[model samples]
Target: MTTQPSPSDPAAVALELERIRRTIEVGFTRTDGALALLVQRHDQTDEALKGHDRRIDDHDARLDTLERGETERQKRDIARLDALERARWPLPSVAALVAVTGLTLSLWQLAAR
Candidate 1:
């Protein structure tokens, strides 16, 4: 058998229904606001990441330029050193002969004494 609700129960049921409706409305509004904030945050994060990537690319280009300059300078320095060494190559042999002559003269004088 189907039971019909009493008139006194109708008022209580209406009040409960109104409360449920208000709760649902508040929940949907809060969720919508949260979703909007999340979308804004994601857009900002994407822009910041793009900026960081661009800066990194610029830094890499600068580093490559500096390395090329350094390599050129090192090559020039090595060439200059090589030229200096070539210019001085004969001095050591001349100095060695002079030392030997001096030693022979000293030994001859000692033997005569």
Candidate 2:
């Protein structure tokens, strides 16, 4: 027949078990702190991405406005050019006018002389 352990040995075993429980609690606390830090970093990253998206949308709106302005300017330039072409006047034919004026001037000079 075997003898049972004494009460003093059981007390020692209880102390050892308490120490192990404390160690596990400290490790879990450290892990909780690290997880909290990671969550904070993720939140900051999300905010930064939102800011970037807003800036991109602003740029897109500005680009659309610029395109509309360019189209309007081109239309005005084309209309002005067309008006200028339509308003142009043709000059008289040079050779026939010169010959007629020369003959009239020579006859007038002979009559004067």
Candidate 3:
């Protein structure tokens, strides 16, 4: 619904061209600012990721130490069980000896009477 500029109007065409150039310059300036901000955010994210990696590495070291301690505890427990197993037969041998001694005493008393 708007009237077109007359082909003969050089001044109007030149003014329109100047306005478009200014608009494009503004858009380029804004785009540059946005890109700069993006770069800063990316750098910040990289630093945070590095910090996380360090924490993970520290956790791994702690876990390794914990695992070694648990292994030593388990080995000690197994050794104790083995020693207990080896000592199991002496109790029955001592009981047999007591019973035999009592029987011998009874027999001797009967003979003496």
Candidate 4:
């Protein structure tokens, strides 16, 4: 009868030990590769974030310039309106008064004649 090798056999123990060693080595190698991939992805994410920050800063600066320009334009418009307001009624009022005085003088002269 053929006998199967038991776990207590020295040859069987050595073979099992070699298999376990090979499995652990392969696991370590895969773990190193995974860590390298993780580091690379982290670096890529960091670069993208920095790029976004730069774009946001540029947009903010542009917006500030636009706001300043709009404020200046609004101030100019207000000054123009103030000038118009100052002139609104005076010229027409003076012309109307002169016309009425001339008409009154003509009427008085005709009545006297």
Against the true structure, whose TM-score is highest?
Answer: 4
Which of the two candidates, 3 or 4, achieves a greater TM-score against the reference? 4
Q: Give TM per candidate.
A: 0.51, 0.55, 0.57, 0.58
The positional error of residue 72 in candidate 1, measured at the CA in angstroms, is 11
Candidate 1's C-alpha runs over 4 A off are 1-12, 70-113
Candidate 3 weakest lDDT stretch, 10 residues: 65-74
True-structure Cα RMSD, model 3: 5.9
lDDT of 3 by residue, 1-113 (tens): 99888868998899889999999999999999999999999999999999999999999998987777666777888799999998787888889999999999999999999
After aligning candidate 3 to the native by TM-score, how far in Å is the CA of 1 from where it should be? Answer: 14
- Assess the local accuracy of residue 35 in candidate 3 as a C-alpha lDDT between 0 and 100: 100
Q: Residue-wise lDDT of candidate 1 within 8-47, one digit each (tens)?
A: 7978789778999999999999999999999999999999
**Candidate 1 TM-score, true structure as reference:** 0.51
For candidate 2, give the lDDT of residue 55. Answer: 100
Clash number by candidate, in order: 0, 0, 0, 0
The number of clashing residue pairs in model 2 is 0
- The positional error of residue 104 in candidate 2, measured at the CA in angstroms, is 19
> Which residue segments of model 2 deviate by more than 4 Å?
1-8, 70-113
